[model samples]
Target chain A: MNDKPLPETLLPLEVDGVSFRHRGQTLLDDVSLRLGHSGKTVIMGPNGAGKSLLMRLCHGLLSPSAGSIRWADGKAASDPDVRGRQAMVFQRPVLLRRSALSNIRYPLALRGMRRQQRTQRALDALRHFGLAELADRPARVLSGGEQQRLALARAWALQPRILFLDEPTSALDPAATKAVEDAVRAFHAKGTRIVMNTHDLGQARRLADDVLFLCRGRVLEHTPAGRFFDTPSTPEAAAFIRGELVW
Target chain B: MVDGNPFAKALELILGLDQVLVGIVTLSLQVSLTAVLTAALLGLPIGAAVALYRFPGRALVVTVLNALMGLPPVVAGLAVYLLLSRAGPLGSWGLLFTPTAMVIAQTMLVFPIIAALSRQVVEDLWEEYREQLQSLGASRLRAIPTLLWDARFSLLTGVLAGFGRASAEVGAVLIVGGNIDGVTRVMTTAIALETSKGNLPLALGLGIVLLFLVAMVNATAFLIGEGAKRRLG
Candidate 1:
């Protein structure tokens, strides 16, 4: 982890009253939240609860049909600087059809980092993720766990201020899941705000500082991980905690 | 008809290294390869742009390109011939009845095939890669090279398909090249000329060679594509 502070932090992400509609149907309705510059925040919900949709809206991959998402200093997610300061990892680990080293170097190159420096940083990232041996190998051919780890290493190379992961370990085995969780912890330790979406209650309990629970398209509860787990807040959440299906 | 079996004579002509047969084969390869190269240079980017960008009339453009993939070689040759004729728009170059003119005609005939096939290929790749590349801060323009590179093997098959069209067509080259004895007599035009002149053995020999060449090109492309797909994926 680079201990050097980012020049400007895009912290305190404020998503206010955002609604996303597709065709005639609403997918994420009146989603609102504020996240400061710390801790792991996991968005937990049942299937089709709009957890992934909300994260996409916040990450600027999809725009909300209604309201706004602003970072620190009122910068919109569309701001290039804000976008440059954040990174995302998808569930299936979308690695470029290139060597693992090049996959890590790609975003750094896009940020206009010079060749030598970006290569060194990419190599360091690969080493950090225990992927140094796979550096020259094509990324798409790697085992699923290694590919996801490479995805994390690629994110690490960016040194993002916030990392959004959408069910990143949904397809992984237990060992691979542990590796991804450890990588998430390392990112949080380096002060990168972690906003993840997952339906796994055990994972949320293990990693979330605050849990944003949703049922249908609405946020049911936004409570600390402890309280969200211990107390019965919403019936949907309680049912979810008890391993029962909601919606 | 020749006295011996046509296939035996054709095989003998090929193995005997007849100068005329070799020359025609070489010129055929040179012209078609050059035309395919030119078409790829122009068509790949055009296809990629069509795939990546959203503009007015995009559907119309795609439709036209797809339709043009089945364009008649003679029609393409006639268009080039008209352009290069003495009183036509590009007549100042005096490129009529030349190998360059054949190259131009074949390029015209092959461009749409390459472009339309590549558009389909790059479009599918773009669909798969769009969100991830966008997340990495890659604009659509910047993503073109990456998409093209990642789709290289598939695009190579497109280029080879264009080459196949160019090499196998007789009408385009015959019209523009005038089938001149040494200067512009490619295999297809020579086969047509020889057959019309009642020289069955020579025409059959050229036909055999042309079939072999096209088969070899396709085989090579398939092997390379499969090998690289395994290595990269």
Candidate 2:
């Protein structure tokens, strides 16, 4: 759906020796990974395994205390061009205290999209996500499912090259989870790269192209979805796949 | 002995629509409203800035603002009087003993209250909105309008509190306006004057009108807040 040519590609995200510390405690320790220009990569780990923290680091929400995260074209995350090409949806769906339409319109406005064009794009995104009727409703008051979908709609309006989902459906019911998963597939179908975190193995199996398994802030495995599930490389990964607590 | 009940007389004066009473009421509204509008215009941005930015002495500034919210009206009036007196720095403009001087005094008294309350509201909102706005590429400065607009309902209560302070205080307006007849005279000063002169009926009427106006302002704010909550929620 993105007819306009991109200014530059932002793929092949390279995380080099990235580490994060908080209050003298290291949360992510010497983590390094390379993401190429494709696939829905699911980050699976037990609680407190630094899955969300690592995603946030890659999305530029939080800076690493050590090493660097670089895009393929060398644009810094602080650059507006790079920021304009990425979006993140938090676990709780941080909707604005505004109408659903305005929530979608806000980022477009920040990107300097014209009023008429932004409104048109926002409406198309809402319609695409099947939220056309609730466009005028206050975003914060919407049901959990609707709010998450609206969050997706907002990200969709941005036409992000990469989308980060941090446990997006963890708080939703089964029906809502299904809707979010479908929306995630929709984003992937449009050629947007997806990086997500989930504790739900079934969800991981359904959506993951590759799985990155983590235990205690260390990456134990990064393999294709099938191989990672069928034959985990590390003891931690094996215990995790067997539904035993590893952390 | 007074001629009749003060309440009955107040109702009579109000129902009769006496010209002097109307003038006093009109002038009181003009001065206080002007003061509130001016204070809000200046204070809101200051409050938002203090909430969003972290500079040296920010904590001290916030503490000073909170302390200033309790500034005595007479002290504020005296401060303005000194600034506007013949020997004072701004005396060249000769605004002393005028309606504008009264407005300045009241605005001075009200600014701190608005600024402090708005700072608290905006700070709380910023905490909730920080991550989402940052992710959207909005700088702290760019997020101001959104934060302010979202905090509008709470800010309205702060403005009303400012209005209540301005309309109720006689010390500041009296010192600055000199209670001049048909000129700088307003409801609070006129009430004080008529009471001392044993013109109890007029004083009581002004008091009743002032109370009614304050009630109306509060009711309107409440209804607006409730309506928005229901509709938006």
Candidate 3:
């Protein structure tokens, strides 16, 4: 589903010795992994495994207590230009108190896009996501699934080089979950690197090209999607895949 | 100039558009509106700045502001009176008994309310939108307008609160203004003077008008807020 080639400058995200601590508690303890040039990478682990915290640290929403996160072979991840080329969707959608269309338009507006251009881009995005009819409604009032769709649509409108999702569909029912998965697949097809985290192993199996299996704030396994599922490396990963409590 | 039931006399003056009443109303509006505008101009940015950034002494500033929200008008008036009074530091300007002095007093009294309230509104919105806005590539400065616009309805209520404070205040305006007839006398000050003179009707008249003005300001703020909510939603 390649729509356009990704910019060469965006590839090969690198995390090295990154650790995050808050109030003397280590949330992510000296974890490091390299995400190669392309494809959808899913992070899976039991609850409290720091999956969400890791994504936020990578997304630059939170600074790591130690070490660094880099993209494109040592390009600082937190640089505004780099961050501008990226987007992150939280578990619960964070929408502006604006119209559905305005929510889509806001990021574009922030980039100094002209009003007319922002309007048209937002409209195109809404239509692309099949949210055109809900365009004028306040984004906050949308049903949970709809708000998630709108959030994804807003990210889509930015044409980000990297899209980060933290449990994007965790709160959705089956149908809604499927819809979000479809959107994620479409983004991957469009050549935006997808880094996501989910506890749903079924979803991980369906969408991951590479698996980053974290447990208890440490990386227990990073392997190809098929191999990670077929020949589980760690006892923790195996226990997790079998739906046993592994923490 | 006339005697009888003060309420009826007040009505007659109001209905007859007494020049004195008209002048008083005009000056009251001029003074209070100016104060509100000045305070908002000074307060909103201060509030937004305080809410959006972490600086040294921020907690102390916020605490002081919260405390100052209830500053007595008399103290504010007394302070301005001191500042602008003859033989005082600012006495050379001779602003002590003028409408400007009342505006200055009201501004000092109400600035904290507008700033403190806007700080709260912006702070709440900042919590909600901070991550979202930052992810959108907005710097703290860039995010202020967005947070302020999104919280405009609540901010407008803050403005109305400041307006109410400025308009209804008597002690500060009275002490600083000297309640000069046809000069610095506003509705509140006029009411005080007229009541003390046993001119109950005129005092009652001014009181009614003041209440009406306050009600109108509050009603307008509510309607605008509701209109925005409905239209946006």
Model 1, range B12-58, lDDT digits (tens) per residue?
A: 87789999888888999999999999999999989999999999999
Write the residue-wise lDDT of candidate 1 on A161-226 in tens digits: 999999999999999999999999999998899999987888988999999998889988999999
Q: Tell me the whole-model lDDT of each prediction, alpha carbons only.
A: 0.90, 0.90, 0.88
Q: What TM-score do all the candidates reach, one by one?
A: 0.96, 0.96, 0.93
lDDT by residue for model 3 (B21-60), tens: 8999899999999999999989988999899999999999
Lowest-lDDT window of 10 residues in candidate 3 chain A? A1-10
Off by over 4 Å in 1: A1-4, B1-3
Candidate 2 segments exceeding 4 Å error = A1-3
Better of 2 and 3 by TM-score: 2
* Least well predicted 10-residue stretch by lDDT in candidate 1 chain B: B1-10
lDDT of 1 at B141: 89
Given candidate 3, what's the lDDT at residue B75? 93
C-alpha lDDT of residue B91 in model 3 = 94
Residue A58 error for model 3, in Å? 0.7
Note the DockQ of each predicted structure.
0.80, 0.69, 0.63
Screening candidate 1 with a backbone cut-off below 3 angstroms (N, C-alpha, C), the clashing residue pairs are none
lDDT of 2 by residue, A174-239 (tens): 999999999999999988999999989999999999999988888878899999999988988999
Winner on DockQ between 2 and 3 is 2
- At residue A68, candidate 3 shows an lDDT of 88
